[model samples]
Target chain A: MLVHAGNSRGAMRGERLCPAEVKRGLLDGNPWQADPSLANLSGVADALAGNGPAHRIIIDATASGEVADYHAHWLEQGIHVVTACKLGSGTTLERWRAINDAVARGNARYGDSATVGAGLPLLRNIRDLQAGGDTIHSIAGVLSGSLAWLFNHYDGQQPFSQLVLQAKDAGYTEPDPREDLSGDDVRRKILILARAAGVPLASDEVAVDSLLELAADGASADAGLEALDAPMAERFEAASAAGAQLGFIARLQDGRARVGLERLDATHPLAGGAGTDNRVAIWSDRYCDQPLVIQGPGAGAGVTAAGLLDDALRIARSTPD
Target chain B: MLVHAGNSRGAMRGERLCPAEVKRGLLDGNPWQADPSLANLSGVADALAGNGPAHRIIIDATASGEVADYHAHWLEQGIHVVTACKLGSGTTLERWRAINDAVARGNARYGDSATVGAGLPLLRNIRDLQAGGDTIHSIAGVLSGSLAWLFNHYDGQQPFSQLVLQAKDAGYTEPDPREDLSGDDVRRKILILARAAGVPLASDEVAVDSLLELAADGASADAGLEALDAPMAERFEAASAAGAQLGFIARLQDGRARVGLERLDATHPLAGGAGTDNRVAIWSDRYCDQPLVIQGPGAGAGVTAAGLLDDALRIARSTPD
Candidate 1:
């Protein structure tokens, strides 16, 4: 049964909630009735406080830092937090430590599988390897689905600007395509992976060579789009001449992270994925010679929802009644 | 702390056990000290019985069906079983059901990640998808490391038999190369995966087209090794002509499992792996247009050991103190 549902705007009891009502409200551009008794974060937390034998879980699906602030508090209250938000562990190293510390202090689980690779087992594998006493040497990946699609289809024959617009139209990118082109999403993912692999990499430590810099200002508004065409065409031609593909790569090694566009050989692990696939190669003490690779649809609403549900199920199974 | 150690021959207390002694004994071709009190299954069970607050775990590293028979009993007695053995869940439907029943009855976990894809996350992903309420439409993969290695190197110029021998020498295949060529290992893996996806498929239901049949008798003995040359060369040529690569693929679809050699296009999800990598494509309701793919080193002692340790750590963490 639904205990409570809330968003940044307000909170409410979920006793009489139904998916149809929620969907209708979302379609009508209005959602969630404000209940004063449960309107604040503390009220919601109090409603979700775990005092019974049954496990209590709070799912964080927002990108709000305000909601992320409640993660440690809720976890410390013995409430499990399954989050899709990157703000928890992908922000400052201090916040990452706080979430983990809260888990230890309250014996609660923090399921952040949906934070990276859309729950493709990347984080789980890294954590499992570390738990098994394997030292992670490096991790490299094509972490951004929008960038993957962009590079996969950018053959230099078509203008790169046209391709970006096409990708945006196809729902492969955000409405503000600059958000994807900025490479910050990839930076967050790499940070999450690095921290998971025992490296406390701060957000600013990752040197990002964003694709957005290639486009002139007002590129998203259909003007100045041609600025990206010549440079991108040149890079594609150079990569083709060397029998390589251009990929937006995120790398973490020696406790450092970098995200940028790179020319990778066809045989490279990160260069083998198709369409919007997020392919990652993990190098560790055990898997030293050939890195362990995982690839799949990196971003989608259905898969993300499935991932959150998977995390919840895992917590439910692990928690003792 | 080490509680007990055992093998097919006998078992002993782990109080004074050390890796050095085990290594020396193995080098000397004499492994265990055969204590009579812990010699048999029941004696070993009694020694490992969960009497205290501490969690009890049994690690099964053997390929013995005899040892697999005790999984239910040990689990029913509140002892966790972390196994690399395929005989437990990859066997008959009845045995698989019995193990699950015992897990539910005693609230014990059966860690079988090492059973398929060595230490890769194939089984875990399939399980997580199912747990998240996603319907698995199909799962296809190059599940055998030995076969993957063989096909990856088997140009029409090289004799398939020579490739098999090379794989054996490289430790990619079992000492008896026929075991790898027979396709039975892939069959067992497909069965395990199918069952994990909620398909209660029997062992006999999988139709395996063994590569061993291509070789005339005595192929492993060098006397008739060249007998496989013509057929394999012809098949390889046909696949090349069709712009496809030959892969020993295991597939589970429509509640059925099949293991055989199939010609896959360059763009096929399972066709992109390198050097003994186990590449798998999982098709489900959520991942319909494009399957979720996972690739990694499919077989290695270190990875298998790591998988077992990972499982043990999971159980230890999950168990309430």
Candidate 2:
């Protein structure tokens, strides 16, 4: 079933959307009931209270960090959550702790496998390795799909601005391209990885070096591009001349995290990727010398949805019949 | 508590080996009890039958294929099985089906993640991706740590025989080094990977190319090396002249599986590992163009034990308290 609390255009407010109605809104495939009155969290909870326990709950929306507290509340109520929401787990360490604590107390699961790398097996691998008594030393990667797309296409042949515009058109960038350019998304992803690797890192601890130097408040895609082109062009030129490629690299090492544009040699592990692929290299005691690498499509509606569904299946299969 | 069914040397034919005894057998880290009466499957089963349901049972022994039926029996008795034994899952398709059927019938989990790649997360990733609706295309890798060591060190500078001897001395190769050279281990692993990718592949379906031309049966490390040097030398010369390196490559693609020595370019994903590191590249619909890469130490007592313990922990944590 599709239950929407709100929409970008503010159209879903106070409406309990059924699976069929949601499908119709998304180009009609299956018919589902529409509950116009089941709009917000409390309404959804009330609706759920009328039914047996859910197999699992899937959250796949933008900036889902706003519902971080609600996620904790749900976990405390013994409900499993499978989310693609970075905000909830990628927020401050304090909130991350609360959510984890609630999960433990309620014996419920919080599946954020889709939060980073579009449901890549990175987090689960880290957790498993740790449980096996391996200590993680560091993690580094090209985490942002939009940024990866931008860098992979931003050769000296094309103006960086053109590549940014193309990425936005390809649905690889955020609505405001500056969000991709600013490097905040990459920071959030790194934070998520660090936490999964057993690091209690806060969002503010990451030293982010955003591409856009101008004020980012209320900027549109074109406006963000205009502000970012000059600086990015310079970086591309310098990197190209030095026989290197530009990669928006995020690193979590020695209890410190940072994200920025870095020039990586052609032979560098993270230097290879076309389009919107997210590549990550994890370094732990067992994998310390040569990091275990995971690379794949980091973003896209289909892949993200698949990741969320994967988490749901894991929970369902684990739960007793 | 350690339960001993049998020992290769007939030393523990009917003994219950405690943790301290096992440690002492490994050069005395701690002392353990040695009960010689628990010598066979029926005895172990009888002991287990007297107890309540176990959360999990771990099988960490050589030639564990002999116990494939026993593992299925345990799983049918409501016991989860975590195995370092590839034989249970890598056996003939008929036996494989029976074990899987038992797992489903008993609603018991089978932790075969430790069987291949030393619990490198390869199998689980493939399973999860398939469940997530992604179609896997192919999986290729250098899966054997002993062979990987031999190849990485077998530059034309050193005779291949000497490298094999060194590997055996370093505890990298099987006691019967012919077992490592016969390509049987790699074939079994490829079969496991293909099955994990949802292919109902039979063991005989794979067209395996063994490294040794002469008979390897009952051959010691020295004897196998003597028989292997000529063919291996020819390969090294041809590959070296072509600026390529030799690796024992296992590939599952296009509904066919093969394992043998292959000449890989310098930049091949599996060619970068050093020492006993095993590297794998997985291709799928979502990651079709750029295969997901995973590299790490594929063999070692510490890492393998860690993998087994990791599987045990997974089954334990998933079981209700």
Candidate 3:
């Protein structure tokens, strides 16, 4: 049973709450009343403190850095933290080190599987390979689902801006398509993967080639979008003439990370993925000749939630009474 | 830190043994002396006992059912078992149940990642998906490294028998190539995956269309292999005419499992793999339209050892002090 629930909005004691009902109420925009005594993170933490020996877990489904900030504290208190937020391990190296140190100091588990590639087992595979004494030489992937969709559907016939608009309309991109086009999301993902592969890559160390720069400032949004057409079309046609496909790739090799648009051969590992699929290739000592490739739907609420639940189940099962 | 070691041939206490020395000795075909007191399984088990609070693990690298029989006993005694052998979960349903029950009863881990895709995260993904409440609809793959190589390399140009000989020469097939041609290994893999997906499919329930049946018996081994050429060539031609590729496929759907040669379209998820890659496509409620695909080199001694080491590390890390 759930003992406590909290979000950026508020916190509540979940002793009287039914999970199914709570889910329905939230989905229907008729949420249960928040407790006056449990309206903040500190209140929720206090309520979660005295829950006997049963394993305590905090499922952070939000993208808030505020929530991620408490991950170390919660873990240091012997509470397991299962998070979908990237700020935990994808941000500053200091925070990542703190979390690891806290986990060791308090003997807690940190489940961040949902932070990268949704639930595709990318991070787990990297960590496991490292644990097994395999040296990871490089890692590359189409890390962003929105960019993948845009690139996969972008043809020279249709303006790239039109495809971006369609992707936005389809709810595939962020509200501001610029956020998706800026290439920062892919950068974060690469940092997360690189760090997992034992590379200490800072956010600034990654060189990003932003798609947003292809557009020009104009009085209207559509006009600004039109400036992107010629540049994108030229790149696409050049790639096509060379018998290659264009992909927004995030790569970490020799401890340096980069995210950019690149033309890849038809036989390239990243070029084979279908619509919106995030394809990751890992080059390690064990898989040096032919890299291990994992491809799947990389962005979905259901999958992310499932990843969180999977982590929770693992913690619950691995913990002894 | 090595405590006890045993194999079908003998056993030894590792008090005076260095792991690097042992590895070099075995590779040089000059092994350390075996202790007579630790020459058998029971003797090794007795020595493994009374190791205080440190996590105990038994790494099974052999393909012997006799060794598998002791898995439950070891697990029940709170000794974790990390294995590359298939007998633990790929054999009888009773043995599978016994192992799982023993894990629960003894609070021990059973690391069988090496049993499936040589540590490609196939089993981990399936089990995690189930744990997270996702309903798996189906799973299909080209499972056998030997068969994958044969089919991937077999064009109508070369006789199938010649390719089999080449595969054998390349160390890609079993000593008796018929063991690979029999489809039983694929059957075991399918059974293991199906069981992981919550389908309790018995071994006999799987309908295996063995490729061995296509060859006729002859006085000479080469003559018997020659009989396989025509049928395979015809199938190859037929598939090529349809713009499809032939793959040795193992599939589980609707709680039924089957292993056979399949013709797949270019767009099929499992059709894109190259060389001896084991490509598995998983269909689940979360991945309904596009199956999650994992592809990689499925067989190698280094990878198998890395997988065993990975499982051992996980058991060690997850266990509380």
- Per-prediction TM-score to the true structure, in the order listed: 0.91, 0.82, 0.88
Cα lDDT tens digits for candidate 1, B214-311:
77565555545567778789999999999999999999988888999899987788877678889889999988878888888889898899889889
C-alpha lDDT values of all predictions: 0.84, 0.75, 0.83
> Going through the candidates in order, what fraction of the true interface contacts does each contain?
0.66, 0.49, 0.64
TM-score, cand. 1: 0.91
TM-score of chain A of each: 0.92, 0.87, 0.94
Q: 2 or 3, which is superior by lDDT?
A: 3
How big is the positional error of residue A311 in model 2, measured in Å on the Cα after superposition?
2.0
- Which candidate tops TM-score? 1
For model 1, how does the per-residue alpha-carbon lDDT over A91-118 read when each residue is reduced to its tens digit?
8888888998998785789999999988
DockQ winner between candidates 2 and 3: 3
DockQ values for all predictions? 0.60, 0.40, 0.55
How far residue A74's Cα lies from its native spot in candidate 2, in Å, is 4.1
Candidate 1 is graded, for docking, as medium
TM-score, B chain, candidate 1? 0.93
lDDT of 2 by residue, A28-121 (tens): 3221333334335554444344444455353545565556667887777766778888888898888889888988786678989888988778
| Number of the candidate with higher TM-score, 2 or 3 | 3
